[model samples]
Target chain A: MDTALSIGSAICLLLGSFLCLTGGIGILRFPDFYTRMHAVSVSETSAAGMILIGLMLQSPDGIVVIKLVMILLMVLFISPASSHALAQSAMRHGLKPWLSTTVPAIKNKHNETASDITSDKGVPPSNL
Target chain B: MIHTLYLSLTLAAFWLLNSGHYSPLILSLGAISIAFVVYLAHKMDVVDHEAQPVHLTLKLPGYYFWLTQQIILANISVVKHIWLGNKTITPTMTTVKSSQKTDMGKVIYANSITLTPGTIAVDLIGDQIIVHSLLSENIEALKAGEMDRRVRQLEH
Candidate 1:
């Protein structure tokens, strides 16, 4: 059981590290700032979450698991929020969307429907 | 009715689990602590119709599992781009009008959005939520309204 648990824990940690590494790669490789944000946000949350769960599983005592869970709760609470704030700041600062390679009749595909682009109302959509 | 009690019970269990040991004295102390916290929250008038759980059950595990999968896929996508070694991260921001009515609903929606990779909620103003994305593609995904639809389903 201990060996099985250790194996599980190791797998989780490896996956978590992989997630982080990929997120960084995404941040560096994505064509635009927005794309990078997508990578970082997704990878960070999952990697952290999986690693914690793995650690919790490996713990012999219930107390450690509970404490680890509390930590998980904290991650669930804060990381996304901070990411959201960062994205909002970037947009408010006038970051532009990337142009697509596909040459459709109408450029700025995002602008077709007001609702399709931005929320119901905020800033007008920038042409893609 | 049962759900609220269950939540309270869960909280109590968490407190006990974290505290360790199952002594009667400690159990009573934990109960008192939980009661005090709940009472204070109620006195603050934070408890209301929206405070109720809309989708309280085992299905939450499904959402968590799905979310984790999405995270993995997203991580892979991001990593691939990064390894390509081109400066491709483009940050884009936009406001989304939240369809959720209750405060808890909105909170859940916001939190869920954050949970997803590559998208972050900047600020939720009134009914509109401002979000930033690392990839403009993430914006396109959001425009698909998958997140909104799923989160709304979780709400009553």
Candidate 2:
């Protein structure tokens, strides 16, 4: 039984590590902020959960289980909220979704800098 | 009324559990630390009606477990896509309305959406949320109303 439990824990750890690896890759390969954020969620929630579960299984003690559960709860509550806040802040600042062809732009915080907010007004470059 | 006690007790328990050995010295130190922190919090006027709703806290575990499952599935999908080098990626932006009534509920709803792989909540336009998805399916999933429903349940 102990051996089986150890094997189970190892398997869980491997799976969790793999998921985390993929999440990192997705964050890099995906085209936009939103997609990257999605990748981060996968890494933060699933991989962490699996690892925690694996640890819990190895321990088999009530207190250990409770601690693991608490950690999981903390992660679940914080990770998503942080991601949402970041995304919302980005959008509020008028970050545009990337376009395949045009590389959609957003108006720079100042007109003088490279404009990120794409507008077709053909406004002349301001010296400011 | 109960939240402060709960938080303090939790803190003390956590301290003891983490400190590894149970002894009178450690126990006294832990008690002092917890009391000091709680007292400071009280003096700062940080504990009051705005405290997180304890009733809603019960569903926290469920939300976490569900979210973990989704994350795993999402990781597998994303990894497969990368390995295949498939150009199957479909990026799109969409909007959805949140069903949550309270400020905390809305925050949770938005956070949950961002937590899922392939979907990110970009903006809050009043009750409506602007989200970007890596695939049309992700957007459809949001439309399916699961996230909104789960967040609503937490509010109760």
Candidate 3:
């Protein structure tokens, strides 16, 4: 049981660390702000969750497990809220998301063209 | 009234969990603080169904289990795309219709979208949520509405 638990915890922690590393690479490699947020979200959600769960497995005290769960729950709630707020504010400020030219523009029910925003040239204003 | 009771119970649990000490003095202090906070919450008019959401307490665990699976799958996909580099990424922004009628339901739907690694819910207007995705397939999967249906089920 101890060996199994240790192996599981190690796997989780290693995976979590790898995810966090990818997120850092993604932040640097992604073309624009919006896409980078996706990378950060990956680290915040799964990576954080994995690390917490890994810690929970190693914790002998029930209270420690509960505390870890509380932290996980807090992260699960706060990360999305903050991400949405950031994305919304960026959209409100007219920060156009980068799109690959190969994919055709998708038209929603409102008939608003997302490609139109992507067509705008130059970098988004740094003041934001 | 039930909501208030649930709120107090939740507060008490939170206090006890955080305090960890069972001394009479600490216990009394915790009780007093919990009552004071609950009273303030009541006065603030935030002790209602939306605030407590006791109705969801039973249902949320199942939804969370499902959501955790989705998150893991999405995370793996995003990680692969990251390693493959930007050339393989098909960044797309499109709107998806949320079938939920209530604000809480819609919020859950939107948050689920945002919670997934490859996609983010950029904006929500009524039943429509503008979603940004790292891969076009992520958006396509969301358009299929499995997550939306699950959230709707959770709300009810």
Order the candidate numbers by lDDT, best to worst. 3, 2, 1
Tell me the lDDT of model 2 at A53.
Answer: 83
Q: List, residue by residue over B1-156, the lDDT tens digit for candidate 3.
A: 898789889888998997788999999999899889988998999988788888899999999899989998999999998889878888888889999989999998999999989999988886788888988899889989899999989887
What tens-digit string does per-residue lDDT give for candidate 3 at A1-128?
Answer: 99999999999999888989999999988888988999999899988988998999899889999999999999999999999999999988877887776667564456344446655533443533
Instruction: Give iRMSD, candidate 1.
Output: 4.5
Query: Ranking by DockQ, best first?
Result: 3, 1, 2
lDDT of 2 at A111: 31
Q: Candidate 2 lDDT, tens digit per residue, A40-73?
A: 7778877898899889879957778878888987
Residue runs of model 1 more than 4 Å from their true location after superposition: A21-43, A85-128, B1-7, B52-59, B95-98, B101-103
Q: What's the lDDT for residue B9 in model 3?
A: 90
Q: What is the lDDT of residue B115 in candidate 2?
A: 71
Model 3: DockQ against the native? 0.77
Give residue B81's lDDT in candidate 2 (0 to 100): 66
The best candidate by DockQ is 3
